[model samples]
Target chain A: MQEELFTSGRNIPNIDPYLDVWHWPIALYLFLGGLAAGILFFAALFYILGKDEVYPGAVKKATVIPPIALSVGLLALIYDLTHPLYAWQLYTTFRIESPMSWGAWVLLIVTPIAFLWTFSYYREAFGGIESKLKLFNKLKFLNTFEAWVIKNRMNMAYALIPLSLILGVYTGILLSAFNARPLWNNAILGPLFLVSGLSTGAAAIIIMSKSMKEKHLFGKIDLGLIIVELALIAHMIMGYYAGSQVQLEAVELLVGGEFTLIFFGVVVLLGLLLPAFLEVGEIMGIKIPVIIPALLVIIGGLVFRFVMVEAGQLTRYLY
Target chain B: MRYAMVIDTKKCVGCSDCVVACQTENNVPEGFCRDWITEVVSGSYPNLELELRSERCNHCEEAPCVRCCPTGASHVVEGGIVLVNASECIGCGACIASCPYDARFQHPDGHVDKCTFCHHRLKKGQLPACVSVCPTKCMYFGDLDDPNSEVSQLLKDRKYKTLAPEAGTKPHVFYLI
Candidate 1:
């Protein structure tokens, strides 16, 4: 509105209507972190419930992904920081109220646990290599901690379940913490992001799952997550439309404004709906290309982050 | 001491002397500013009322930027003046995104920067650069807690409105209509 105001005098004020601080790197980091967390949550949950025996490939792929994705996500975050060299300062001090602090600590804890979980698959490989090479057999290794970790893995799996959930939800809290941005200031964002992350994580697992049953199970799980995400997004938009003046201004960015096309097209349609349709067809015994839907869901997840982060910046209370 | 500013929009003449003087006094980088002015137009056609307002950081009592800063780089110092510690700033842009007034900006040298209410002058027991340089003498600045302070007297003598009170920032700056 200030941009439309007709003032006779020179407008010397620096009227910044929207934020330009965050970019694609932040979105990339959010998606990667959420995806990593989702994978670990599924793997740990199934392992604790004794369901992992039926889907060994899915469990293995899921365990390996969390650490790799988290490492790459952390790199993106560090790259986005203006003072990348001073990143150690984040770990030096902690702020209870800052969501960034929570995120840094959560990632620090989850990364090591996820990496250790992947080592379960390495035992077989190490055994095979030692059998072929007599030198490796003579080179004794410290097995006490590894044996203890293996023996208490079920307890560790239980601990990782909640940490993984926190990792997924913390990424959403990062945006929701900014009360100034109305698009992101909602209670539902935590659940919405959690579901989205899980959906994408399921899709990633589906691509790598060796058994047909495991692939089908993940496909169904992804479908459920997509449905919940759609409902949450609808609620988020409706709540904003019914909110105060500034909130309406924030919603205007999504409804029919600059972000309308991308939000509806990439995020809702291709990302959620089409994938849902394809997955349903697969469940009904109608042959659908597996890679097509999996890649679409992953791409859709990335686009969702891009739209929310970019459009959230465009919605502001001040001009 | 709760230092504050009261700008009288009725007396302002739209001259940008305050802006120039503030840049000079603070050595604000080129393409950046610590203080500036805004022109507001109300009504339509012949009944239009044009008002020139000197605008800067409100130095809010509950600054969202300070609350969101991960490293406490954006902080409130003596006199309740919210200032950024340049050395500690990570330039993560969290403060910039949290400010409802859009008062903060990332400097080219990689730190958040905004109006300090001329804290340097306050140390010398002098008025702020903008308040001192306004040709029309429309801006008033002083310790709001002191009964005899110019800002307190001006606030008591005139009716005023703060920008975006609904924002719940409790801004230290006021506008005398």
Candidate 2:
């Protein structure tokens, strides 16, 4: 009765004692991917609605986050792959049910669009680049492509709306598809990641925008997205709470166990609630630095993915 | 025709002959195995129940690993044996995360690797390496579709349970308690 000890026979390195198949790289990839999706989404959405002038940050400024974020995110994904050189195999066939397949195809088609959309506005963003370098004028296609893109930019906006939504949600569905992991086994994860992406996207705009109206508008947008994300998180936790015994154990990782402090404190309190309250205060005439709330939301979004990926991998059906 | 395994947990001594046989037969690589043993001690010490069984890929009927595989790499073949086409696997670890069995590993050659139910042996009309090498004769493998098969008879007669039954993976591995 004093003590009891049990020896583990399930000893397989990298699998047996503790499952460590996915790590921080996967988490980082997911966060950056969602962020890029969000940035592309709002940028395209406002352009489609003819609010390009009213929300120049969404269309031109924050649009810059996509190309940079996508490149880094994709690199993280490639870095995680044990068969990094074989990544091109993903494009050979499309498994409609596979979220990774969807991710591959979507990124392939949308990544170029994100760059092209940004390039279309390069002249506006860097008005005198051609004059300063004198080499830009030699690439006549660049000017012709810019003019063509500028004309059909609305069509690109139309395409990005659906594609961005898929990319944003794809990050979450990627985890949820692993029904073997009880923590990531909920459908709510899709919308949760999507809303978090929107919030993070809006935060990017708020960080980069110089206009007071654009900053204020995005603060409100991030605030709204954070609310939706919190609600989704609640629904997800509640689903787990009311779900099977395995799912209860999955939620326990957040509520009463290893993930409690970070999930509630960092992701919820600091990432979502603190930033949310700050945004509300700003609306109520309390002046706050835009960087403060924006950075908090971005950091929260990043940590949320880490929590989900790390904790989800730890939750298994066999335990 | 579904091929399956039936292990008599009550007779298993946890000697790990199955683990070695699998490694040698399939060339499963160092520090890795296609099958292994698990021991559980439950209840008070005096009345404790000890259960030992060899475990491997369940070759699930509703295999999530196959479903989640992006490049059609992890797939089910004849007799419901799940196999990974190493060349096609991007090693995204989706199938790894999706498997309730924890049966797969990233091979050193940079591809997904797992138990193929001794597919090469089966093709030659031989028993799976682990089943044939079990010292206790506690392990049995055959086509469950045939009523005369030892696995079918044992499962029909013995009180057996599968691992993670709640997962609804429809696991083909059975442990006769």
Candidate 3:
């Protein structure tokens, strides 16, 4: 065995092996937020480029998910905060350097836009369906608001594109900004999270959409994102491999250490690669059930966040 | 007036006087501490060297904890001492993760807490409780800006090192090995 040293500060909360300051709630929140960002980015991109005509499911129908996802995500975020009552202080001032500050503001802006985008498709999405809830059907202000949103939908698209990109990248940067965790100290995490989010968003559309054409289209899109995700993961691992002693130990935690099985066996193998191959088979007309690959992709996205957040905490500069 | 700390590792016997002294003086809660001892062993089995360090906040000149606080809770005051504004902190733990030294801790009261270098004691021209009670008198505290200060003199005369120097944090705590 190599040289071993021990300490007496075993009762401390977030030191060494006990380092779990951020937990499953933060992981789940990041996953849902990234997924929401992915859905919004694509929904906006398809509309601005006039591809909404060809991909109505991706453009309009998928917009329904973000508002709900964002609300749930925010609840989880609030639940995770130790001093959640003080969270309002995030809005009183703005610091350009703080990623959390950037995230707080971006989420505040995007959640409303996500609702507005979905509402613009109100007549098209929920027109003929009869509802027992007479209150929703009777709101005169809602009808006027919907009309206004429809008219401004194009302008909203311009704002959504950049905001969604920042939201997606912000989830990853939130972790990367913590230079103390050697595993999350890489720059590629931003692009990696963005691509992973898009893949999961595409999967959500494929599962939710009834049209065979929409399912096939998103399958192909997800395949491309999976490729990019794999490349980024490889590049990030290489960067860690080539880094200093601390980084080497950090990578070892993923490669052959405690996280090897869950990160590789579950996230990389089950979450990413398996779903990607299943999608490819679907694209080749192998008649795979639409839900299997798509659901796998979604599960993969959630597990990916768990792996990153947990593993990053296990890594540190000192022993 | 940049305050700095210098602890002579050779003279330290790992007695943990600093830990107990800081706790009582600061009224730190049970199962929590502002500073603790760390024992590091490096090199292979046959050629090993052990070092004991009484570690606490680095009080970095380029503090990431100050930068990452969503609210202006964690800030650097005069003398390059990084401190948390307990009333303002959201206890989001971003500053906790940002620290390379793992110095900051969330108090049971829902705000972050760490070694303040006894800022209150210093205000009365008194030494920090830990430094005052150290049996070996190995711990030194003074303004690094003044060339005549003990911390400045010890750093000049001896070969010393700071923890996690690669972080670019420019830590004020020095270890005279």
- Highest-scoring model, lDDT: 2
* Chain A TM-score values, per prediction: 0.89, 0.95, 0.95
lDDT of 1 at B17: 87
Instruction: Rank all candidate structures by their DockQ, best first, as comma-separated numbers.
Output: 3, 2, 1
DockQ of each: 0.46, 0.59, 0.64
Per-residue lDDT of model 3, residues B1-177, tens digit only: 999989998888888889999999999988888888888777877888888888899889999999999988888888888888887888888998998988888888888999999999999999999999999998999999999998988999999999999988899999999
Which model scores highest in TM-score? 2
RMSD (Å) per prediction: 3.1, 2.0, 1.8
Candidate 1 chain A: minimum summed lDDT over ten consecutive residues — where? A5-14
Which interface RMSD values do the candidates have, in the order shown? Answer: 4.2, 3.6, 2.0
Model 2 Cα lDDT, one tens digit per residue, B1-177 = 999999998899988888888888888778777777777777786887878878889999999899889999998998999999988999888998899989888888889898898999999999999889888899999989999999999998999999998888999999999
Q: Give the CAPRI rating of model 3.
A: medium
lDDT of 1 by residue, A246-269 (tens): 889888888889888888988899
Candidate 1 CA-lDDT value: 0.81
Q: Give the clashing pairs for model 1.
A: none
Runs in model 2 lying further than 4 Å from the true structure: A1-10, A128-131
- Candidate lDDT (C-alpha), each: 0.81, 0.88, 0.88
Two-way lDDT contest, 1 vs 2, winner: 2
